[model samples]
Target: MRISAVRTADRFLPERLSRQLNPWLLRLDQMLDGSTEHAVAQRVSLIAFLVRIISAAIALVSQVIFARWMGQFEYGIFVLVWVTVVILGNLSCLGFQTTVIRFVPEYLERQQLDHLRGILFTSKAFALGLTTCIALIGAGGVYFFREAIESYYVVPFLIGFICLPMIALGDTLDGTARSRSWVLVALTPTYIIRPVLTLVVMSIAHAAGFAPTATAAVTSAIIATYTTTLFQLLVVNHRFQAVVVPGTKTIRFGEWFAVSLPIFLVEGFFFLLTNADVLMVGRYMEPDKVATYFATVKLLALVHFVYFSVKAGAAQRYSELMHTHDHAQLSQFARDTARWTFWPSLMMAIVLLLLGKPLLYLFGAQFTDGYPLLFVLVVGVVARASVGPAESLLNMAGKQKICAMVYAVTLIVNICLSIVLIPVYGLAGAACATAFSMVFEAVTLALTVYNRLNITMFVFAGRTNARPVKEEI
Candidate 1:
């Protein structure tokens, strides 16, 4: 009887051990899954996108309040100045951020630590030096036009001039963090925290006996940008060091520029393409008219953000897949990404369209006059959605030059259309031009991806083509 009892006890012991160990094994699986680079990028991008949406909501309120307080004329000046800054700031980004996203991941994958470190350092330096020079040139141009420019606009533009360096630096840091899949760390500073803090500061300033004007708002933005970027740099640097030691590899300035210049042109042309409509309106129409158009564009931007969010997540994965020549998986991932970007963006467009009138009302009754423009603008957003984040897939797969060429052509087409249409149709014509140009850009980018990678970046009929590639991922 004792021997029999011992045998039963022995058998039960193994089962007890497995029950104890299974949870730990499950935890290990999760950890391993989380460690994949694609997983990290997707997680970070989604988190960043969510945070960005919240931050953008707060900013929208502030923009409306700020615009109302400043009155239509002052508000128009502010928008013009702000748009100019945005255009220049993006151009000055010089594709370092874009270049970093591509090269950093590839280098890290190949274990080229030196090139990795060099690229990061070089990219940041390139952005700073180039943007600073550009700002100085712009300031010089402003100085030349000071007599022709408004007295109020002069000071605000000058204040905005100071913002360029930090903005450029922040963009470079953002790219670096993204490459490493540090989404919150990369985006929180520039996108979420900075805009929120700017609003807070502006509100306090208004209450504390300071005149509520574009100057105060612009000043608040500058302070917020500097503070958030500095903090981001410190935290990102610490995390950056934790992952990989700096200076373990040599810096290659030459190679970095060779890649960044074409990319810079790509980004620059795209920026020009986007801002051309607003710019032409500003040139030909009254400030009040420009304000109406600008308001509509900002409202539609929310839908566009969804597209960008998916691209943020998909880009790194696309790069990694391209490196492995995993055509089958790449095709599948691109299709899924397209579906994800499109459906959400379409839903967002619908919701925003329904709420468009009220949201425009936030800018004041006069501002709400632009509601029809929302419908025109939304068509572009949804049309772009049909194709997904085509530019990202191209830019990631070392096809940025082709993307740039496409954007350049589109920009030229947009300008020509806007010039002819704006005079004839006014705001409606401007809206039409923008929508037409955007749809063109989307179609061109989608074709570019297909031509370069042979993957369909659309939602329909993707499953039938999911056959395995000859090469492994």
Candidate 2:
């Protein structure tokens, strides 16, 4: 296919048309065929974007099915519980999930195989152990607080706790795989395989005479989560063997933990900030309302997934560049990532708003009420994409402490606004609070990157005149 394009360009294309098409075609060919680091990163970003697109479709279809099967109230309960669990599971890594991404590249670059082997062994063990303990404690808390909690949510929360350790392990494995730029290995299990498995398991359970309640839904999630995570564990471990043969492992517990703790704060606050709106809505509204808001949020993922795709591909490359102390390349790549993130996200956001009503109706007729909120919510998403993955660049550049501070301030603002706004404005208020918070987060992170790293990361920042950072190497 590339050859055909190249041949046509050489033989038949007019001068102006050929001039316009040739550069892009050449870059596409290189992205497909080149062996350079830049080519590899582009390929990973392209593949990750494609995977996220597929994942979004699968998720949307499955959520619509769940809503149809269980009704708004029960589906709302399930989504609330599931979102909480996912956040906790990712947090349960205590930053090791991301820490691995930072350190693994450093280890491999220095040929510190013993430390590499040690970190690989310890990160999984630590996350699994910590999360298991937390899950147990969570179960105990639920048991003790069952009297005060809503009876409908009680069973599902307990079931969600049971899935926590596996979720944590899966996340850690995902980071390990990503650190190696094994894009498919890193993404497929969590994104493609797990969602599909969850849908299949839920269908099987429903067909087997189980009621389509949140409890039943969560039980299906447990089976799917365990099965998918175990499969990922095996694959990541097997792949690691080719990278580093087993030997005497050197565990740098103090150093690893020190690095990971600040990251824990950054990631924790970031996750909470991302989901706090849904949680706040769940707190102040009925289950049906929660379902409506969640459905709206899910539809907006058409725009949201663009940032995540660019982020997933950019983080490891940023880490590599940071370690190399290549200020010029790092600055340019950061700018490139912002462009990659913003334009597609803007396009998707416009498309999502255009289709918002019909898409909401897919959930249920009542969900169309949330359509007006899309306009409010999309402002934040586009504002955020304008900075691309600025937080990622900061985190990779050893500036996570300040990044955490930025997210912390944003989260506080979100919660306070939600508290003040939700009672008065209801779901519209929640949307307003979230959108404002996202805009605040984006502005702060972009400013922080520029101040700390001397890198102009905004999507619209002029490339030719980008400020140069001091070289650390």
TM-score between model 1 and native: 0.89
Error of 2 at 334 (Å): 0.3
Off by over 4 Å in 1: 1-41, 150-152, 463-473
What is the alpha-carbon lDDT for the whole of candidate 2? 0.91
User: How displaced is residue 431 in candidate 2, in Å?
Assistant: 0.1
Per-residue lDDT of candidate 1, residues 336-356 (tens digit): 778877888888899998999
Candidate 2: which stretches are off by over 4 Å?
1-8, 11-16, 464-473
Q: Residue-wise lDDT of candidate 2 within 250-309, one digit each (tens)? A: 999999998898889999999999899999999999899999999999988888888988
Candidate 2: minimum summed lDDT over ten consecutive residues — where?
464-473
TM per model?
A: 0.89, 0.96
Which candidate has the highest TM-score of all? 2
